[model samples]
Target chain A: MERIKPSLQLKDDIDLHISGWIVQRIGWVLLLLLLIAASLGVFGTGWLSAGHVAGKNGTVSFERIARFETPMKLVVQIEKADGDIEIRIPRSYLDCMEIDKIVPEPATQKAAGGSAIYTFDAEAESTITFYLMPESTGSIHTELTIDNTNFPIAHFIFP
Target chain B: MNPVVRGVAVYLFLLVVFRIMGKRSLSESTTFDFVLLLIISEVTQQALVGQDYSLTGAFILITTLISLDLIFSLIKEKFHLFGKIAEGVPLIVVDQGKPLTKRMRKCKVSEEDILEAARFHFGLEKMEQIRYAILEKDGSISIVPEKEKASIK
Candidate 1:
């Protein structure tokens, strides 16, 4: 075939073409990994991120993985309480999240010793649910003390 | 999160995501691509503003994104390699009536795509009637017809 030379003088950078293809392929792999992690609750809610902590008093349940601005819940299941029940939640947790509502409202709440002590009327058994809206994105670790029992909980919030 | 940080993060993430998706992924060659673009913008809006619906939030995000773009443009202008890496260059796929197989394959371009561009752009009927077909930086094909052929309007 007789070659018709093109007058177009476009820069043919050898390295750019090779690097472009290589980079895109790598990006595909990374995107796939991201999707897998997301599906597994690394970014939000999944089996891998549903966490719970148990104490003699009861078991505390919450999402270990969550997203900023996405509403989630922290539940405390109480066993037999002789009288008024007091649960101490850390100020750190309060600082990171805003409690929207509490199921079975507490009788009174006091802020002391860098924690909030919420006193609730004792029932043989009951569940306290704190609807939480994360204030920001980061890892938060705190302990909920119920009747001298400490239940540790941690959460990782994504933006 | 800080508005500036949110804006910057979304900007860079979207840039990387589009780059990873490659040039053709959202080129609007089809109607579905247009719909995908709309969906992407909707999702991006929620992430950018979060819960804040005030004009201040909007202003801050707009300023932050525009500033980032200006800074990146300046940097790319200063660095040739960076610009090429950030935005790909136009490559000639059909050169002198022959398809350049290597670049075409690397770019995920098919001969049919080039022929389609040829027919749509210049009404050229055959590969021989197209002198050169360059895939532009923005994922569109520009065809140069042979001087004697494909002059049909």
Candidate 2:
């Protein structure tokens, strides 16, 4: 038998620890950057082929924007500044389901002084759109959530 | 509380819960381990980020978890008896260049695993070349080659 040395040994070094920490944090930072990049791509493009826009009671509303059939979730973070958001579903987007009849609880609700959060889920390879109208006539910033998928087909614009 | 702080809290709570479950909660875990891990995440998630989420709530839970881990690791390190109980001691599968088939069967280690370990570890393609083989405490197989090759005579 050859003289065998034991394998387990603890590693130590101030530089190594600092370098390892940097490497670990870099991975997380890259992941966050990728998410932000994908989101920007989705929010900057228009893929929902069909949509409807309505101006009613001092509010301009757009809704029923559907993506080509695919797993899709659209979350809009409407900033505090303006009116109520009115989302409508285009009949073409609802092939087998009736959007008007079925009401889902909003996944999240965060608002203060003219801001609202909305989240919508749609089947993969299906079309979905949302309408945003300010309760008062004013411009507002918008933030959209795309979760884990690629960018949405259409970019959201707030005015 | 900041998200980092919240994460620490949820982690601690899970450590305590899992420790209470047993050392097998981490080692020798089967399908039950996966289910428990999933449920623990869900439960801790709720506690960490509920409507009234607080850093204090999270820190307390996290401290509890780290404490449990430290305690268990300490027990395993300080007490040989507890270590053996927690992590089963290594079983001898081959002794003096002879396979102990009974011991292998008792330890649930297959002949193939032993052969694979020998081939990969010591580059020994034939079992005859191995003087001893042991299934280690950490579920790995170790090989000791025949001493005759080392004899200068």
Candidate 3:
């Protein structure tokens, strides 16, 4: 029997260059590193607190811009002078942000303007904190009403 | 983000990541590979749903992923180049009873792997008894026995 020598010629010439493959491998590694960094809050814009206090009914303050998928703190301080008041925040906020944890979980009531009203009895000056994570990017504009005062809060989520 | 959009994004991301990992990564799954797959799925679940755990959200995501997979299959069927790029082409690791050492090394396949496949499929004892051993697109070894050896068997 005649011995047949092996042939390595493929029907179609495919680019099997190790350099090209290495480049693609490096690209994916960099992408994964960037994703991990973002998740760890590195290379992320820090919690941006809205300096403007809308103290129409009571002093209500929170971070204006929340970084995408990054947890942030939202604080609302109610004055003793206001007594017991209902704070209304737009329900649409839930679409863009996930509430991880909230301090002093108050009794919630449904309100107009697609908002959820949280009733807080201010025997003394009270502060509530909300840990929030922004889900999407772009501008989020919503109205937060305290008692009869409506405060329009607008923030841009960084991608 | 919409569940459908989130699903598509996750799917694309996973596809790219796995593609970079190479075909063998999917074909050969050890115990550690199974654990890695579970971890990957858990992480993907969080990214796909965010904080939305509603049944509706889950349904939308499942539908979107399936639809995208179907669309890609159709596209692959229509375009040969796309199919090649997406699934890769079958490579000849052993030609005419001779092992292609360079190609096998690049593909992370050893001579032992081909020998094992040959032994399993053809009851062949040596590499010389095998005519061709192809590293398939799906990461399987397809063995073709030598004409004389096959006839003798």
Best by lDDT: 1
Q: What's the DockQ for every one of the candidates?
A: 0.50, 0.03, 0.22
Per-residue error at A53 for model 2, in Å? Answer: 51
The candidate that achieves the highest DockQ relative to the unseen native structure: 1
| TM-score between model 1 and native | 0.91
How well does each candidate superpose onto the true structure, as a TM-score? 0.91, 0.34, 0.64
Question: Sorted on DockQ, highest at the top, how do the candidates line up?
Answer: 1, 3, 2
DockQ of 2: 0.03
Ranking under lDDT, best-scoring first?
1, 3, 2
Model 3 clashing residue pairs (backbone): none
For each candidate, the alpha-carbon lDDT, in order, equals 0.86, 0.46, 0.74
C-alpha lDDT of residue A148 in model 3: 71
lDDT of 3 by residue, B1-153 (tens): 678878888898888777777666776446766787889989988899887889998888889999999999999989987877777777778877888787787677889989999989988988889889988878888898897976674
TM-score of chain B of each: 0.90, 0.59, 0.89
Candidate 3 chain B — worst ten consecutive residues by lDDT sum?
A: B21-30
Model 3: lDDT to the true structure: 0.74
Fnat of each candidate: 0.54, 0.00, 0.15
